[model samples]
Target chain A: MNTKPKILIVDDKPENLKALRKVLKDLDIELVEATSGNDALKATLCHDFVLALLDIQMPGMDGYELAGILREEEKTAHLPFIFISAVYTDNLNVFKGYENGAFSFITKPFQPEILINKVKFFIDKHQQEVALYELNEELKNANKELDAFTYSVSHDLRAPLRAVNGYAEMLNEDYGTHLDDEGKRLIENINYYAKKMGALIDDLLAFSRLGRKEIQVSEIDMNEMVEGVLIEMNKSITHNAKIKIGKLHQVNADYGLLHQVMFNLISNAIKYSSKKEHPIIEISSNEKNGKIVFSIKDNGAGFNMKYADKLFGVFQRLHSQEEFEGTGVGLAIVQRVISKHKGNVWAEGNINEGATFNFSLT
Target chain B: MDYEVEILIVEDNMSDAEMTIRALKKNNLTNKLLHLKDGAEALDFIFARENYSDRKIENIPKVILLDLKMPKVNGIQVLQELKSDERTKKIPVVILTSSKEDPDIQECYCLGANSYVVKPVQFEMFVKVVSELGLYWMILNQPPK
Candidate 1:
């Protein structure tokens, strides 16, 4: 449990301080007492307070004068203060109290219940503000740590991987003539696995970059974008596959990210369905609830609907490496990019029937 | 060989330096390639100062393949010093590093790097990249008189 909130009570007379302390004794608070304005300022120097109650008729420096001083310093500028006085109850004095950043005013011989309610309000508000400030600081530190981690992933991790791959390739090139068939095959396996690792690293880095890169939003023609991605990824699509692209609507999104989403989905459609003699992949879109729902359907080795929920996760794949080759980061990246545009990604499929990947832009 | 340096590679890691040199050698660029262990040595060789005073500054290499993270002085610092100096500013400096971090790329370009290439993790790709870059810099690119 949190400690009781601190309250500073300042008055010149011993009886006035004693009376204020006695009334507040019932409430859960740690109260500090001061006999003068100077003493109160010194007390503030050593401790933080949730509420400060000051008497208006103190010697040398009065309550309003002390509040003015607190307002000038950044440390105590926002400190909640309540001015108490018997003689200074006029309209001019009360207005002066507010001008010096007084939160509330309590006259001498004020009601015990009224003072308690006002004190409680300020204490709760101060605690809430402090908690919020701490939470904001934590979020900032987390973002900084992520940036550092990504930098290391890009540089430090890849360096050793390059060394491993490079040396293995060198060993194969230099000693292939002397090695037996089995020896050569083992080296080839090393090379293959190393290359796969390199691709995975590249995919992970690209995914991390999407989180940091600022999105540039603009109008994009989905049909034109798909046509362009198909041209770029022509080799990935098999010669026997038939691709049908239906009417696609224009959308407001980040052009580069939308292109990636299409690339990953279309390539996935072609790859999964490539085993069939006549592969059929259809791309279509429709408007629903003032948002565009784009879908890709392929007649290939479809996954079970039971694991559909895991389709968009990073490195999450339903198919084994023997059936299909992938780093499993494509769908994860697609999800992240679409979500960044205030959109959603989901899939539906059955065993050996086919799969349809759908996404919406809001 | 007329003591002319065609390609100056500044790399700190021993394995990377050897592989980079071997890649260039495979492309038949073995004759005039000079490999320095760190940025400080590269700077000294370029300015022909300290222990390198016997060498002529006017005979600067056609290209400098500089790695970013190094001891004594980093790649960005070397690029900055070279670009700011009138005597050595004309030589092309390629940033060959494992880091594809945005800030490093932006800073290297701002410091007057001629080209930036991330070191590929696959050995075959690394060899291909190094050989292509070597041929392009040593044979294709023209330096000022």
Candidate 2:
């Protein structure tokens, strides 16, 4: 493995190339010699050079012309160049060298230390960029692998849970008359826990799936969406919360994902405020600072403001399962869906006080 | 083997197959139901090859309840084989699987699956879905003469 950095040295004269090589020999680098501009182009095709040293007094093509040609080609467009010139030593010539995309210019009677310093700078920079690119690729692969693992694990978990639930149901159906009261209760507990685990797995799968789902954006009427969500919630939940919905503004978002966000927020509000004497749930939306902001406020059992940051985390519940029945994945899913749309979610509440959940879409 | 088969269930999982049979039995639809353990046996049974060579190919089941994830050739392959062959293409194939997370559902429909149903984890829901499926396919749906 050739781990050494590569440098392309383009000079018509052999002694000039040798002098440049002698200066850079102390640094661990592989020097590729190119006697002409065309040869230098060919070297670029074979090797990824970190930096190029061009001599201005070449026969057919000057250093400035070579740098300009390299800039024209996409392969070597960003390849940094150091122009070494004896004849074109004037201020205008230096400016012309820069206009042709030269990083540094040196006269014939130059110190080797100055040239070495400039070359080292570019080499270090190129190495850093390569390292960063590799790190990014690795992170992407790890994320994809995690999603696949979560998906398959959650999927495989359901089969066993189904069996547990199925067998328990079978036991209850076939032996209900023979079993004692405690025995039947034990069977019911088994069934209940099995169903709960199934729900948790389902929620985990849905959350993991959000990472890979491509967001399809469409205009959604907030009023109509809220109405539909309320009707759906009414089918599953029985609550006496006096729900008041204000006029909402239409926004562009993925219809399905946004529906989930609304569903989770409203359901949480209803669930939390069900203990209130006169439970009141208010839903409203407005355009603020060039973004649409929606808020759902509920006069129910709210949480302390101290643990507010942990509210949106996956399976991070502030309350116990006894106080509130949740797998703690709803808010996490809501956060993911909103973030996927380039939106932000937040809340404000105190212990035993009302809470307001807000989300903004740009 | 000689009796006419109305519903053919191709599932590798024994518990799931038993539960499905139980569900079908509730609706009185299991009189002619036949359960195969894997996709290879299912292919052999449907095409009347290998171990099933003695069985006639003309005895097509009214509906096939196929599971997506199975050993020795999955449901997509089974669905493709059944849909492509003219003799077995008319038999309705309903997909019953544990997960809807994969793109197999779209591919199943694209390959001419009669219906795609995800098996619920809850026992009561599973029984309801499976029994309804049996009543719909066997009693209500009319198969070709």
Candidate 1 lDDT tens digits, A108-169:
76898899899989988978988898898998789768866865675577777788877877
Candidate 1: the clashing residue pairs are: none
Instruction: Give the range where candidate 2 chain B is weakest over 10 consecutive residues by summed lDDT.
Output: B98-107
Q: Cα lDDT for residue A215, model 1?
A: 90
B-chain TM-score for every candidate = 0.96, 0.96
Across all candidates, the chain A TM-score values are 0.65, 0.79
Task: Write candidate 2's Cα lDDT for A1-362 as tens digits.
Answer: 23888999999999999999899989988999999988998999999888999998898987888999999999889999999988889999999989998999999899999999999999889889889989999998999999999999999998888999999999999999999999999999999899889889999999999989999999999999999999999999999999999999999999999999999999999999988899999999888899989999998899899899999999999988899899999999999999989999999998888899999999
Docking class of 2: high
Model 1 score (lDDT):
0.89
Model 1 chain A worst lDDT window (10 residues): A147-156
- A280: Cα error in model 1, Å: 2.8
Model 2 C-alpha lDDT per residue in residues B1-145, reported as the tens digit of each score = 4647889999998889989999999888888888998888899999999988888888889999999899889998999998999998998999999868558788999999999999999999999999999999998999988
Write one digit per residue (lDDT tens) for candidate 1, span B1-145.
2448989999998888889999999989979888888888888888987778789999989999999999889888899999999999989999999887888999999989999998888787789999999999988888778
Look at candidate 2 and give me any clashing residue pairs: none
Estimate the Cα RMSD of every predicted model relative to the unseen true structure: 6.5, 3.6
Q: What is the TM-score of candidate 2?
A: 0.86
TM-score of predicted model 1?
A: 0.74
